[model samples]
Target: MIPFFRKIRQKLLSRNKVTRYLVYALGEILLVVIGILIALQVNNWNEGRKQEKISDQTLQSLEEEINEARSNLEKIISFNERILELSNRFLAGELTKDSLENDPTQIFYLTTYAFTTLNFAITEQELSTERTILGRQSLNAKLRISLQDYLSMGDLEELLGNFWNNEVLPYFIEKKMMVVYNRFLKQESINKEDIQQIVNEEKFVNLVATTNSMNYQFLNLLKQLDKDLEEALVLIKEEEHD
Candidate 1:
């Protein structure tokens, strides 16, 4: 193709067809420019496709993570509700010290009440890739932007960590809840009056309140995350089919 164009130019120059030569030269330049533009467009299209594929994969991974988050949130909510029940019962004298003394349900909630953070490890490297994908999504529909907001919040995980580290575990230590817990664990005979006295204390009540609050917070985030996951899955499914 190059040689053919060169031969044509040579012919025009030899004939002193200056106007024709200039026109041909201009036409050649225009063709070259058009070719370059076309190549750039193709390259851009390819890059976008690559990023979209990465984003799709990331969304799928997020769905899995969201499922885990939802599961954790559900467990937390149930446990918190149980604690709330226990608290209410103790205060109302419905759950006597005798009942509290033998309550495995209450013991489990207190012992394993730490935050279980969701693993976003899949997105560690894919966030930059997802920004474009997220930006292009519908925010109102809990699409990409909503997912972005959910991811950015990280509140559920942080809430659990804060309570466990700053309040939950510390309260147990500072308020001697742990001592009561240890006594329970040691299979020692707990005086029914002492158990009643312990549950009715200000510290134990406060812990119950905090636990309920923490669980509620976790549930709220998880609900949103669950919605976001459904929205994301719909978007991804449509994209995949398209």
Candidate 2:
């Protein structure tokens, strides 16, 4: 192809067809420029396909993580709900000290605490970087909001832990109520007076009330997280089709 064009140019030059030769030279330059542009376009297209494939794989991994997080969240929510229900009953006098004394295991339930430990694929910083990579506005927004909600639960969990360590545990120790917990562990019968003391103590009741309130807040956040995860999954499914 090069030799053929060279021969044509040589013929035009030999004939001193200067004007036609200039036109032919310009045409060759135009063809070369067009070819370069076409090659760049093809390269760009291939690169785009590679990036899209990577984004799809990332989304799938995120979906799996979200489902696993949801499963864990469901179990935590159920456990805490039981604690809330039991605490409410005890506070309202629906659960008598006699009932608790019969089943020391019930004391274990009252003393138990719930803390948020849900995990997710998107971090605060990663969300922004992922937005640029994934190029899905709705999915990105959902992820950002969901992660914020999820991270905020950490504060509530920390508060609950501090309350248990500082207030509730101290009260138990000061009142010598640790004996009740020890009896629970040994599966031994609890002393009636100790049971009555725990059930009737004003400070203990207040502690249970405070924990119940925190549990309600934690449960609400978990429920919102569940909803956001569901929405995120839906968005991922849609993108898969696209």
Candidate 3:
């Protein structure tokens, strides 16, 4: 192509058609400029396709992740409910000493019912790598808002972690409370008689109530997150059809 253009330029210049040569030169420059622009636009288009593919894969992974989180949350919710039920039963004088002794390890389990919310591991990684995720044109307003809210829950998860460590854990693992079964420390679990005696305390009954409250809050938080997860999937489907 370059050689053909040069040949035409040589012919024009040799014929002393300087005015026509100048016009030819201007046209040649325009063609070159147009070609460069076309090439650049194609490159940009390819890059955009790559990004959209990445974004789609990210969203799919996120859907799976949120679903997993919701499933886990459901299990946790059930667990918390069971804990709350048992505690309420004990408080209401429905649990006999014989019944308590029947499940002696209930003391260990109930007292140590500490839980942590699942972190958005892959979602966070994707967001960190792609700062423009929320602003992405491929992501609709609804999905973006849900994602933003869900990401912000990291702070809430962290807050819960701190609370569990500071208050909940210490409350349960008090040396006088549970001589927990520890292989590392070679500590033996308390006898059934000891567990029965421990559960007989007013503080133990009150602690059960406190745990019920904490578990309720945890369940509520999970329910809200589950809503976000469902919203996110709905938005994903909407965007796909659009």
Candidate 4:
């Protein structure tokens, strides 16, 4: 192609058609510029398509993550709810010592700490790194902020951990409250007398009440996180399809 164009230029120059040569040269330059522009535009289009596919994959991964988190959160919520219910019945004297002794797992339920399921570290890190791929700068920023706010509940989690370890567990051990459950675990016949004795104690009632209060607070936090995740999922889905 280059040799053909050079031949035309040489012919025009040999004929001393300087004016025509200049015109032909200018036309050739314009054509080259247009060709370069077309090539650049096609390359840009291919890159955009590749980026869009990647963005879709990222959003799909995030959606799956949110769903898993929601599932785990629901289980934790149900467990905490059961714990609260048992604690309330026990504190109100509605659950008899016989009932507790029959279901030694009731004791297990009341003492267990509430668990959290708000893990967005992977999601957050991916979003942060693929900010351009996600492309809703303001929405992405808002979701990141919301995720951080939920993660801040770690402080509450730590508080519960310290309370369980430093206060609750030690107190239960001293009172031999866990001994009944341990014996039950070994398939040993639970001493009904021990269960009755623990229930009648003021410290037993106090610890149960304290645990109930803490678990209730933790449950509320999980519920809030659930709502936020739902909202984020909605926005993300919209962005994905948009």
Candidate 5:
């Protein structure tokens, strides 16, 4: 193509029709400019398609992450409910202190602690990654907002971790230690009345209060997480439709 244009220019220049030659040269230059513009436009269109594909893939990944988060939240919620039920049983004297100390109920609370710890660790990493991806300013605006809200729910979950460690664990540990000490120190001839009185003391009452507060906080957090998860599912469905 370059050789063809060169030959045409040479023939035109060799002719004495300078005005016609100049007009032809201008026309050739215009054609070249138009061709370059068309090529650029095509390249831009291809790049746009690639970007959209990337955005779609990112949204899909977010959907999977949100689903995983929902599952984790549900498990946590179930665990919290069990904890509350156990607390109720203890408070109502449905399960004697001796029974609580010797039976699997104590093990249940310990297992809950372990699970909560593990879940918090794993969720923190997932939440951090979600935040990083959401922070990417190059992402689509709707996706960014949806991810931000999802991450906010994660932040709420992280807040619950503090309640677990500081408030909940201390309360359970004190109760467990009292039961263990009483059982071991006064074996066979356990003073049930005296033990109940001790557990009903003002300090113990405060500890129970703290435990209840923590449970309430956890319940509230779970509700918020459920709402966010539902919203995220809706967002994913809309994206799929789009």
Candidate 6:
């Protein structure tokens, strides 16, 4: 191709058709520029197709993660409801202390179980990969922003960790203390004064109330999580349309 263009140029110069030669040269330059532009355009389109495939894969993975999260959340919510039911029965005196002490249901109400059950583990790498793919400036702008906001605000791992440590753990410790004082110590026929002394130590009353409140708050948070997950699914579906 190069030799062919050279031969044409030599013929044009030898003819002394300067005006026609200049026009030919300019036409050749334009063709070259157009070829380059076409090549660039094709390359860009291919790159975009590859990126879209990657984004779709990422979205699929995220959907799987979201499903897992939703399932886990449902389990947690169910468990919390059970705990609340048992606690209410105990509080209402419909369930005797002895019956409560012996009930297998009591085990389900334990904060330790809640901690273990609700502690949904997620790897930072998964989130980072999702964010990187979604962060591309080439992505649909609204979709990119939606993904960013979800990544920033709707972190399952962080929410689970905070709920377990800040809310669940302390609540469990307080409940254990209460069980030891109100049930075990009382069973042992410990002096009322001594039991009172134990209850008075280290903000025991405050802890018991806080523990109860934690269960309530956990339920509330679970509701919020369910809403967030539903919203995320909807957003992803919208992105698919675009």
TM-score per prediction, in order, is 0.67, 0.89, 0.72, 0.82, 0.63, 0.64
Worst lDDT run of 10 residues, candidate 3, spans: 176-185
TM-score between candidate 2 and the true structure: 0.89
Predicted candidate 4 versus true structure: per-residue lDDT over 22-69, tens digit per residue: 999999999999999999999999999988887788778778888888
Error of 3 at 69 (Å): 2.0
Model 2: lDDT to the true structure = 0.80
**True lDDT of residue 171, candidate 5:** 58
The number of the candidate with the highest TM-score is 2
Q: Encode model 5's per-residue lDDT on 1-242: one tens digit a residue.
A: 88988888888788877887889889999999999999999999998788667666766766676677667767877877777676666556675556644443242242132123212332344345654334443333444454555455456556546755675457557665546444544443344443454454556545544555556565665657566556756765776576
Leading candidate by lDDT: 2
Give the C-alpha miss distance for residue 184 in model 3, angstroms.
17
* lDDT (Cα atoms) of all candidates against the true structure: 0.62, 0.80, 0.65, 0.78, 0.58, 0.57
Question: Least lDDT summed over 10 consecutive residues: which range in candidate 6?
Answer: 115-124
lDDT per residue (tens digit) for residues 1-242 in model 3? 99999999999999999999999999999998999999999999998888777777777777788788778867876776777677667768887677865555665445344364665777667656664255554444444555665555555556556655676567556634435434213544445666555577776666666656565565566567677777767766664555
Q: Who is ahead in lDDT, 1 or 4?
A: 4
Q: Could you tally the backbone clashes for each prediction?
A: 0, 0, 0, 0, 0, 0
Instruction: Give candidate 6 misplaced runs (Cα > 4 Å).
Output: 92-95, 98-113, 116-207
Q: In the order shown, what is each candidate's alpha-carbon RMSD?
A: 4.7, 2.5, 4.5, 3.0, 6.6, 7.3
Candidate 3: residue 173 lDDT (0-100): 68
Model 6 C-alpha lDDT per residue in residues 37-116, reported as the tens digit of each score? 99999999999898888777766765676677778878877877776665556444564435544433342243322432
Predicted structure 3, TM vs. truth = 0.72
Which candidate, 1 or 6, has the higher lDDT?
1
What are the runs in model 4 whose C-alpha is more than 4 Å off? 15-20, 96-101, 117-122, 131-133, 137-142, 184-191
List the candidate numbers ranked by lDDT, top first: 2, 4, 3, 1, 5, 6
Q: What is the lDDT of residue 42 in candidate 6?
A: 100
Candidate 6 structure, TM-score to reference: 0.64
